[model samples]
Target: MTTTAQPQTGRAEGLASRYSTFMSRHASLMPTFAALAILILLFVGAQIYFGNFITPRNLSALLLDNSYLLILAVGMTFVILTGGIDLSVGSVMAFTGILCARLLSEGFPAIVTIPVMIIGGGAVGLMVGVLVQYFEVQPFIASLAGLFLARGLAFVVSLESIKVEDPIVLWFGSTRFRLGEWYISPTGILALLVVAIAAIVLQWTRFGRTIYAVGGSEQSARLMGLHVARTKIIAYVISGVCAGLAGLALTAYSGAGYPLYGVGTELDAIAAVVIGGTLLTGGRGYVLGSLVGVLVYGAIQTVISFMGAEQSWTRIIIGILLLVFIVVQRVIVARSDRRR
Candidate 1:
């Protein structure tokens, strides 16, 4: 009997050891897991508090409203992953919107105007990246300069809001597909597509791996023969392109391009990224996490509206959530370091 008990105990210990090893191996994912839990809780709480919060129409509206921000968050995700910030994204978004409006008003077709806006946004990011990588400028300083340049350019383009009267642009903005009782706008569709593409690029591509490598340690990345400069530049380019796309989305959503649009928008994007479980110092995050973060944001706003509180409360709630997430991230990072 004793010998039989001993064999069973050994087997139990072996199973426990394997489970512990698996947990340790994937420990970095803890923050993302925690974020997911928080999102679910907030979502459920909103539905419970607001009788109509789970309605399909309202949900669709939430997606439509946040589509642009989601796109911006995707771009910002890449830059942040590289342990850098892009303060220019918000300004770039405004510039792109103004540029699109100017182009469309000047009789440029959607096909031409759309691509130009995106490329223009990418160009701004390219400039910032070049300043950071080639000129050895710090990302913060370079992006700050870019922010001012983009805003100045937007004001130069137009002092007042430019209404988009283009038939194609208006049609794109108005068109929607009905799913059951819910309608999804083209902007929402594009947002989902961008998230899917970004997820794949970040998870599977060589460039994506290089991004992580560079973020982990630029010196180590160079020692391993990774093109650190190019990777960094490309991240900014991605961010710029995303900002441009976001601007276009916003233009469609609101049917106008205001030079002052997206002021402080960078902070929102950063908040989303941070809440999504991405480390500000870089080297650990998921594109899917960012998407969930966006949803959490939308859900919070919906909750506030359902409660009939002031709209300003939305910012206050977001600030509190952002603070909590940042604290969680710090703890996760410290624990990870300790494990190492």
Candidate 2:
């Protein structure tokens, strides 16, 4: 009897150890699940509050309205995973939109204008990365400079909103596919494609692993012979390019470009990233999580709109959620430290 009891106790201890290890390994995923849970709850609440909020038409509208934001969040995820921030993404979006609008107004084809916007945005991102990696500039300051430069450039291009009269641009903005009772926009497809590609790059590629390593610890990453500077810089470039693409999506959605279109957008992206479970300190997060975060954001706005509440409620709710996620992250970091 004593021998049997000892074996059972040992087995229980072994199981407990395995459970702890598993939890430790995947703890970063908690915030993502939390975000997902919040999304579901919000959706349910919206349905309860507004009766028809769960219909296909409303769902499609949510995707269409927030496509640009989803794209921006994907790029922001890459930067945040490296424990860096890109404040310029919002400004880049505005700059790209304004530039593309001007070019289109000048009779440039969509084909030409699109690539130019992407390249230009990438250039700005590269500049920010170079400043941060080579000049020893802080990420915030470097990105802030980028923000100012991009915003200033947008104003320089035009101080007023430029209407996009190009046929292709208008077609993109107005065209929608009927799926039974729901309508889907081309811009929404673009946003989903960006999310899928980002997910693959971050999860499967060598560059993606290097990004995680750098974010984990720059000193350790260098010791492991990773291209820390290149990875970090590329992250910013990806962000910039995404912002540019988002600008195109915005142009398609609105049929015009305003220099102030993406004002405070960077903050929104960061909030989505953090609320999605990406650590502000860097290293452990998923791009899919960012997608869910975007949905949550869109859901809040949808709920507010359906409820006929003032738009300010969206920001207020998001602020409360952001604060909650930040506290959760601190708790996660504390647990990780305790484990180490």
Candidate 3:
């Protein structure tokens, strides 16, 4: 028994050593890996516990139901990657949706209304970026000001909910493409497209590389001749545009736009981005990881619904998971520093 235990201990030590070396070399990816692992485990466990959890219809519903959140997550990923926060995204989304609904009700064409909504959101993002970059305002304070401004403007548009009747606006959410039991709505497809485009840009574009460099070290990025100001500003704009798109998706999904529609949604977006393994301090994360994070959030909600539990339980579980991931990130960061 003693001899057998010694061999087992040796193997365990060897495995641990290998893990440490891998982690030291690839510390940035650890959070993403952990998030992916948790997502897989959650899905597999839920599927075993609830026979229908992994069905095609359910899976499709997952994407469809959370499509708006997914869009928000993509934008949030960009902002967070630059080590900045955008608290105004939720409010911007609400403002755009309400504005869109108002315009459509006034007989505006979909083409006209869509651009107005997207550009409107981008404009608000530009404000935040200018405040942060030029005025040297902290991102949190600038975005909070943006949040208030957008929300106030939303109420100014209309305090009451407005129903969306335009065919083009409605079509994205209502139409579903079926592949057997699995179906995806146009909104879901659009969200996926956004993710794909963002991923490509981040991985292959000069702007994306600049974003990473800025997050890693702004001073260094500046010294290296990267356009830190432009990159940061563009990141906020992307986030705002994404929020606008999310608003559009939500409007289509619900067939109505309310000033209160996106309340607390910024928190949800931030949570998903953080859970997706994007560091709060920035410079290390992925667009695909954000997608996985949204899926995990949706999965938890679905599982809770299946169990007939209250919705708050979902928040509790997510909070615990968030705390765990943050600790993991801290450990990885510390280890990397030690290795350096």
Candidate 4:
């Protein structure tokens, strides 16, 4: 009787332990949920505090204005999820945008120019990933070099803002579909499509699991037969391609490409990813968190404008929040590693 009782008790404790572990591991997602709640509250408060805030026109402007940021955030989420960073994204956007504009001006047509830009961006990102993963180069230093190279390419492509003369291309960036009082936009739709695809890829595929494994522990992932280097490299390439497409959209929305655009945007994308609950030290987080992060960022920008504050405050606010979350993530990850 004593032995039977002991076995039953041991099984109960094992079940409880598994439950606890699952809950704790998933608790990292709580911050992202909190961020989303706060963002909604802020948006509502802005509507109440500022009479003009809720107009369909103003809301549309907000969504359309930040489409590129939205796209880039998705890519950044992947990089952060894998315990890495890519600072050259902004410059890469500039490079792709200018290249697309140049092709459009030279009569390459919309279909060819757009894909070329996106592919070029991915290629550049792949090169950077190769250096970081195989050549053992630090991400910061390698991306910094990439930044300069991309900027140089942008300059070489166009000394002036080049406009796309293709009507279809312009419409893709500017046209809106009406839905009664609330309108849908090309840019917003594109952003949503990209997010959905990224979510599915991250959550459902073998490649996605490899990414998580690689991020969770590089050495362990390698021993377990994961393609850790290839996974990281692909993450970077995805980011680059997304940023490139973003730049292409920017050109359409603005009707021109200038080399100086997207200079500080990569930082904004990184901050949004972190704020949305991604661990900077890596091994945890999701693409949906990035969507929430983009909304939070846009809400903050909107609120700051409503408050009549300097635009620079956006950077300060993001920087402070980023520091706080990063420290918390480091502490959590460190403790978990010790337990393991």
Question: Order of all candidates by lDDT, from best down to worst?
Answer: 2, 3, 1, 4
Better of 1 and 4 by lDDT: 1
lDDT of 2: 0.93
lDDT of 4 at 142: 78
Worst 10 residues of 3 by lDDT: 331-340
Reference-based lDDT, each prediction: 0.89, 0.93, 0.92, 0.85
The C-alpha TM-scores of every prediction are: 0.93, 0.94, 0.94, 0.90
RMSD of each: 2.6, 3.1, 2.7, 5.4
Q: In model 1, which regions exceed 4 Å deviation? A: 1-22
Candidate 4 whole-model C-alpha lDDT, 0 to 1: 0.85
Give me the overall lDDT of model 1.
0.89
Model 4 Cα displacement at 165 (Å)?
Answer: 2.5
How would you encode candidate 2's per-residue C-alpha lDDT over 1-340 as one tens digit per residue? 9999999999999999998888789999989999999999998887887788899998999889999999999999999989999999999999999999999989899999999999989999999999999999999999999999999999999999999988777776688999798998889888999999998998999999998998889899999999998999999999999999999999989989999999998999999889999999999899999999999999999888877889999999999999999999999999989989
When 3 and 4 are scored with lDDT, the better candidate is 3
Show where candidate 4 strays beyond 4 Å: 1-23
